[model samples]
Target: MSRTFDDTRRWVRFGTDLMLRSVGGLDDDAFAASSALPGWSRAHVAAHVAANAEALSNLVHWAATGEPTPMYASPERRAADIEQGRALPSGELTAWLRRSADALEAGMTALGEERWSARVVTAQGRTVPATEIPWLRSREVCVHAVDLATGATLADLPPDFLTALCDDAVAKRATAPGPALTLRAPTAVWELPGDGEPAVVTGELHDIAAYLTGRPAAPLTVDGAPAPALGAWL
Candidate 1:
């Protein structure tokens, strides 16, 4: 089933709440521990999630006002902002995360129906309507919740979201020139873009999505062998 804008907005809120709940109890030492993402601490993941809300809110502003507000000033600045956010006190960081997410949602709610069709560019340079903003944020909070290396897992995601995420990840992967592959889940199968004979990967839907997005996933196999290495999703 396709998701309406309202559906995606609800998902943005739901995912953010879940992420907050997952991280609410972390202390300084817990925040300093390594996350599922290599070389990133739970602090880093929290900071990035907070920064992303602010960045994506820029797109909402641009759509509403017909101004050109890029998600970030530049790649270097984005990285630096995350670093700065990472150093914030845990209390301050969580507060920022909550505030930014609320502000983004308010801005989105204030946008007129017509304004939703206004074009904006993602950090990845893809030009899309403002309607995509909610989905973008949804992916960040939901996936990063798991990246926190907390008890949250992909299976905890809504069934619809898992499918959409898998499809989106596979389509994005297909955009670049790379090896061809096939992803098989119990209920669905996706063909990754590239040349040559596709390496067939088989797993549960959520695990396949996790594998595609570079998250820690349950065991999966490629052509009866261990899953091959993959580059970062974004």
Candidate 2:
């Protein structure tokens, strides 16, 4: 099925809710349980997503108000801010995430399709129409949510979302080297490792997403550079 950006946003909201639901059943200790990713607790991941939503909401507000805002106007300042907030209690983190999502939702809903096309600048100095914020926001939450071990794989995400992100990650390897990711597919022999047996990335698109994001060993082969790239992406 085809999807407009708004459609992507709706699905993103649903996916975030899914991740949140998984965490809801867990206690404080479990919330802080170590997931597959090193240096991040489940609560830390949750707080990061929630805090990001709040940050994105602020940009949306700036756009609505006709004030100056860049994609991440304070790119350098953001890391410190999120790190500080991620240390908050689990209860507070959950509340903050929900609040951030609600605030962004209200702002985006009020703007509707009409303003999505309106031009706005991001902290990185790129100017894009406001309509794409949800795409950005979705990328942050949906992907990071998996890191929390909430049990939802990227396979659970919408198909288009999965493919686009994977392809994007692959293509990015050429120019950005965002992470060393190996894509194991049916037709060709794809191996990122220069050495070692090829571990193929197995399963559906979402599984590829989760495995790529550092969750579990994708039923794929790993030999060389891609293995290190995994850590970079994580």
Cα lDDT tens digits, model 1, 1-234, are: 366678788789889999999889788788888999889999899999999999999999999999999999999999999999888888888898899988998998899999999999999899999999999999999999988988899989987888889888888888877778788988888888787777888999888988888877764565468776777687
The number of the candidate with the highest lDDT is 1
Provide the lDDT at 124 for model 2. 53
lDDT of each: 0.87, 0.64
**Best candidate per TM-score, number?**
1
Model 2 lDDT tens row, 181-208 = 3565442223343344434444556656
Q: Kindly provide the TM-score of model 1 when superposed on the true structure, using C-alpha atoms.
A: 0.94
Error of 2 at 76 (Å): 5.7
Which RMSD values do the candidates have, in order? 1.7, 4.6
Clashes of each: 0, 22
Clashing pairs in 1: none
